[model samples]
Target chain A: MIETDWLWGLLGGLMIGGAAALYLLVNGRVMGASGIIGGLVDGSARDQWAERLAFLAGLVGVPALAVLLIGGAETHLSGNPAVLILGGLLVGLGTRMANGCTSGHGVCGISRLSLRGIVATVFYILVGGIVMVLARHVLGWI
Target chain B: MARSLFSALAGAIFGLGLLVSGMTDTTRVQGWLDVFGDWDPTLAFVMGGALIPMAIAWRVAARRRVAVLGNPLPLTHERVVDAKLVIGSSLFGAGWGLAGLCPGPALASLGWGGWGGLLFLLAMLVGMVAAPAAKARIDRITQAA
Candidate 1:
């Protein structure tokens, strides 16, 4: 199963990268998911609201259409409200503060070899792994 | 007009990729991060696969002064590895490990993630709204230290 999973991952990754490539080559912008949505949340994208909204509409709408067409998708998100809320808050605030996330720093940034992108990726992955170990192994909460 | 259209197209493709690649699955994401336990290496392929086209895109972008649509390229010039970067990334990582959802998947998963996903999205928005002030405070404290 893991063997076949890699194929799907790779194919999907190519699509993702292709999208980012198109966004850059045509839209002249890095397709950082957090930055795109963050601009809307913070109202900094007021000047280009249409563009940002369009992007988000697609980001949200496509998945929705897929769910309807192919049946529902499962997230397997934790049921704990505490975990959900805390994680959500941190992801939002932290992405905003750092100006990137997995798509931004991990994919776009690293591909370009941006030092900030590389550093941010390292910190997040390292810290994320540590937290997972502590939460799952030590606390048994997650 | 073209910009918005292209943006939407790109975003749609990205969302599709997330769904198809299983990045929208919390268990898969958590499994990837769970290196100490039963680890999943599927995400590495995703990351590596994503890098290939993007790297080429960067090279193509370098040769062109303007985007295909004639917009000035919005290339980032940020190079500083400041405290905000470190602290913010650490926090984001913690949240990712806890929930197994980052910004993109969190949004993409909303259609099927049900109430839990909605809750996470709402909380994420609130946190995003409050982030600037938090950063300001962190800056002050760091400066003082």
Candidate 2:
């Protein structure tokens, strides 16, 4: 099955868009992934904890479900887990410094025409682009 | 019992969605898009799973008179293209490439409670604290102009 992934990309964008609306409709909040994750750390917010747990479980679990039904495995994460850990830390710091994750700021924020989101997302893409360059071109990390 | 819960739930779901979509693994994402070697469709399913519900929700929100959370529906209105936008986007991209995960996926990775997730989570905290101060300064300058 060889074909273009445009349909998938469009579909994904729309789904994410729909999520933006739903988050607004239900929670009156932007579906900013970074902030939600941040809320889980310090406070004893139980709902936050439970939903976060469930959602992360679902994120990993759903793939498992898919594999169970469809017989495919998760993509191989090639980097050493140690490297992955270090990468995760840097990303977290970046997200916080920027005020939202790609989903929150890049997708929903820009969609809303938020200046902050617009600015932040631009930096996000560019920084990611640059890092990709360095990792692959310079350091060969990618 | 109250409205605040929706914020938390929605946020969590969004985070989870990021994880399932395999956006957490930067290499996988790039690999899926890459035409070089092995191609992965994991991101495709992840996107589909999210869109199916997302499309439904968008319509629901569009039809609703008031949000369940008692907040106004989301809207967009802006055209202020400035230096901040350029600088910020570049920073984000560089960081993402360096780490192979963004904020959402990084946090979801943390659910495993591994040391890597913890480091990402902590760095994110540092960024969060710094953002507000920067925002305020930018707003002030914008207001002045």
Best by TM-score: 1
What is the fnat of candidate 2?
A: 0.33
Tell me the lDDT of model 1 at A101.
98
Candidate 1 residues lying further than 4 Å off, grouped into runs, are none
* Fnat per model, in the order shown: 0.85, 0.33
What lDDT is reached at residue A123 by model 1? 94
Q: What DockQ does every candidate get?
A: 0.87, 0.29
Which whole-number lDDT from 0 to 100 does residue A19 have in model 1? 92
Error (Å) of candidate 2 at residue A68 is 5.0
lDDT of 1: 0.91
Model 2 chain B: lowest-lDDT 10 consecutive positions: B1-10
Candidate 1 CAPRI category: high
RMSD of each: 1.2, 5.6
Query: What is the per-candidate TM-score for chain B?
Result: 0.95, 0.66
TM-score, each model? 0.97, 0.64
RMSD of 1: 1.2
Q: Candidates' lDDT values, in order? A: 0.91, 0.55
Tens-place lDDT digits, model 1, residues B62-124: 889689989777666699999999999999999999999999888887888989999999999
